[model samples]
Target: MENHDAAALLEQAAQLDAGDPLARYRGLFIGTDTALSYLDGNSLGRPLKRTQRDISTFIGEGWGGWLIRGWDEEWLDLPQTIGDQLGRAVLGAAPGQTVIADSTTVVLYKLIRAALATVSDPARTEIVLDTDNFPTDRYLVEGIAREEGLTLRWIEADPASGVTVEQVRHATGPATAVVLLSHVAYRSGFLADLPGITEVAHSAGALVVWDLCHSAGSVELDLDGANVDFAAGCTYKYLNGGPGSPAFAYVNRRHLSGLKQPIWGWMGRKDAFEMAAGYEPAPGIRSFLSGTPAIFGMLAMRGTLDLIEEAGMAAIREKSLKLTAFAVQLFEAWLEPAGVELASPRDPELRGSHITLDHPAFRNVTAALWEQDVIPDFRAPHGIRVGLSPLSTSFAELFRGMAAIRDQLRR
Candidate 1:
């Protein structure tokens, strides 16, 4: 709030940026050279320099040259091949369990249906869900329950925090067929306990489906270790995939054969080209595919996944913690005094790679901030979500963005 305080914080940011081992990665992005303080990487990540070259190469050598033979050669299995890479680099899943296909909503729908189908008991007719989940997750479940004559058991979650293991335990019972939840809260950046929740759901004889939009690349996941039933996420965020990139779905290998997702398509048949009479699902993860792969959308994320593999998820998570922590420090020193309230968790362990700050004035302040080239997304009811992507976001960039927020709040 004061000049001296601002000066001190600026110096601290400079020191952190200077010492940041991941700092060099900022150069790989397209728009980092400008004065823009891109504080929205949690929403959509910046494109990589390699993405352009990769797309070009695909056009020239892979798609442009190979023609439709591309399907026979590689495109037929592109989803699983890249899905395997994504699993190895980010999802903590083994091969044959993850597939890249469809929009996140479509994938979520398929997985949720599949999970519900696995429950044969006539008494298990309710779906357990949370209040604070993303709109799509809630909407999809609501529609599915309506169509299937299933009841919805809602978990009331605090916007400041997230669903606790205790809440999940209380929410599940004999009636619960499946429990759907977000690994990280979309509004608050609160990280949920995956293993604990999954264990609880299993005890209740319910399958678990995790929404990983905010969890995929920001946090280290152990879907296999947790014995998770199903998971899906968008690649556009910390995974740095371009806009509208295909989402990925992970089904526990144990469920590969028995689980039958509701949607069926020609591509998912045992032999896609067979044009067979009755549909026999493809073996393993490939059965999840409902249509042709989005070759262009998948290209950008490959570069980021390569970077994630090279840097390792552990180091990325460590940097993420530091980045979010540093953003909290700035929020306290500058924004809090300007009447900005921290909407996310105070404890780093409970948080993800981003934090939200709320103020009555933020709705309009967001427009002013964006005009100044300090772009953080505005959530409903006056919340500014500051998403810090560890690879492309610098401490100094965060400081600049926070300073701009403080200035706008003051204005």
Candidate 2:
């Protein structure tokens, strides 16, 4: 923990980063406008240069020139096209099982409602979700529970450790129709044991729906291998999709035939333009789409997805671990004695790409850091989240941010 040891550790980290196969991807993003150390990719990712150009081209040609005709050309396929890329790159889903659609909240609502309907037994009327789930997810579930006259079985999760397979098992019973959780916890950055959790849920005859908002781009996900029943995630986070970009939903091919999304909009119907008298949902993931696709938002996501595919999740994950490890090392060496406790798991295998630290004045400290242009997020009751997007953050940036935090705390 001495200065010499910290320096040496940082030096070794820099060497590893330099030799990393994914190092070059850091340049693919707009890192900063004025040397800003952005440690908030878990909240919102840096915009890609390609996204700017792609938007410009789409605006000028696709929308400006082609106008409404663009729909007939390829505008209609945006959901399926981008959804397939998402499946191939991160979701571990087959092509037809994913589709770009509404926000994460909307997708969660649709999937949860659909799962509720599939459970015909009135006795199985409880929806299981962790108390530590993201606010939006919890809100959506609460709304669904109210609408369906179902009770919610909320599992109390350890703020630092997040939900575990055992916690889920204890919460899920024969009367549980669904088990919902975030793949990587939002505040703690804890990576849940997906396969094990899925097994537990399935054993109790409950369908599992994962909110992959944190893990999709920061971690390697094999939804198909895990036999996930359904999943949803926002692209604007680690995926580098621009702000408010359309989120995605995954419906396993097996479930597509059996589970029906609640929203039966014409866009999700087999023949969307047929103006049919009744709603006959489309097959596969396309049925998850509820309304007209956001052309501009999908274009922004396309650029980021291209970059993600090029860098590859394997390489991205490698750099992500390195970045987070570097930050944790710095905190232990410099800030631990000052009462700063690591809230994230020490073992990288149990964590995602971000690190969280606990301090009494976390909200104030985070705000102050932002004033100095060091951006990390704060969760209530004192946790500072430093998210390192492998494609945009650097070891040097992390070192500088930690140093700033240490210096500020000393004052």
The C-alpha lDDT values of all candidates are 0.92, 0.86
Q: Could you give candidate 1's per-residue lDDT for residues 96-152 as a string of tens digits?
A: 888899889999999999998888899999999999999999999999999999999
- What is candidate 1's local distance difference test score? 0.92
Scored by lDDT, the top model is: 1
Where is the poorest 10-residue window by lDDT in model 2? 25-34
Model 2: per-residue lDDT, tens digit, 204-253? 99999999999998899898999999899999998877889889999888
**Per-candidate total of colliding backbone pairs:** 0, 0
Q: Clashes in model 2: which pairs?
A: none
Off by over 4 Å in 2: 1-10, 32-34
Residue 123 miss distance in model 2 (angstroms): 2.1
